[model samples]
Target: MSGIAKTPEPPYYAVIFASQRTEGDRGYGIMADKMVELAYQQEGFLGVESARDEGLGITVSYWESLEAIKNWKEHSAHKIAQDRGKAEWYAIFSLRVCKVERHSFFEM
Candidate 1:
């Protein structure tokens, strides 16, 4: 082993969140960080990738099961943030969940 544990192959799900922020995002940075940390502690959460520029933000999180995704949706703090995103933070948003039947990655 190269001391770097490889990510497991196949049998995974990805939740992709794409959003456009409203006027201001004064508290969004902190809240986003908190959400990422909380997600890592959730059962079945595998990994995440996020990027933001100007007023657009995109985040993709990997999970082991649909149940885990449902649990995360029902999580209280996340619920609160979801509400805030609708009413205050996001001007527009979209969420997509896809099963990863197969995947491949390359390293330099």
Candidate 2:
């Protein structure tokens, strides 16, 4: 699966979301796809990476600033999505926000 988000230089923010899912889709896939599409439309949205295996999953979204991240969180559709996550999608989840002070990566 392609989960590589081409991020820019340092000083960006990363919102890391880790979770365990319920047994079946239960409309999670549709909501997730809508979120990805909606995120791209938001300002300061750098990129996103996502991975899932069995019941475990992780999603990382890049942003320009903490404010940008906050805005994304408060988005109306995203709020509904969050509610759905709590009610149906995620069995358990944890979220962490961090600043990218420095990073290095190379691809051949």
Candidate 3:
């Protein structure tokens, strides 16, 4: 099945993160790529979308369960990055997790 087909129907979870970086990203690009790769290898991870410009970034990741989301949150490397975000990388940020009961997409 395609990646889109694997997305769970209704009642899935999304982790939305919005951030403003503090300075030059330095190793951020590489780390972000690695993080995406790691997340895809994780059990229950559905998909991810990210975009950034002028020090602002947004990342949204889909998951199968709350437990999976929690596991990702507690991941050691992710925790280290989270600390870096708070202390040095990010000027401001917010994380929101929502239960998605329904969605739709169209392409032309």
Winning candidate number (lDDT): 2
Highest TM-score: give the candidate number.
Answer: 2
Candidate 2, superposed: residue stretches over 4 Å from native: none
C-alpha lDDT of residue 73 in model 3: 90
Ranking by lDDT: 2, 1, 3
Better of 2 and 3 by TM-score: 2
Worst 10 residues of 2 by lDDT: 1-10
TM-score of each: 0.90, 0.96, 0.88
Tens-place lDDT digits, model 1, residues 31-108: 888898899899988888777889778888889999999999999999988988888999899999999898887778
lDDT of 3 by residue, 2-92 (tens): 1333466778999999999888776777778778888888888999877778977888899999999999999998887778768778889
Task: Sort all candidates by TM-score, best to worst.
Answer: 2, 1, 3
Q: For residues 8-39, what per-residue lDDT tens digits would candidate 2 score against the true structure? A: 99999999999999878899999999999999
| Clashes by residue pair, model 3 | none
Give candidate 2's TM-score: 0.96
- Candidate 1: worst 10 consecutive residues by lDDT? 1-10
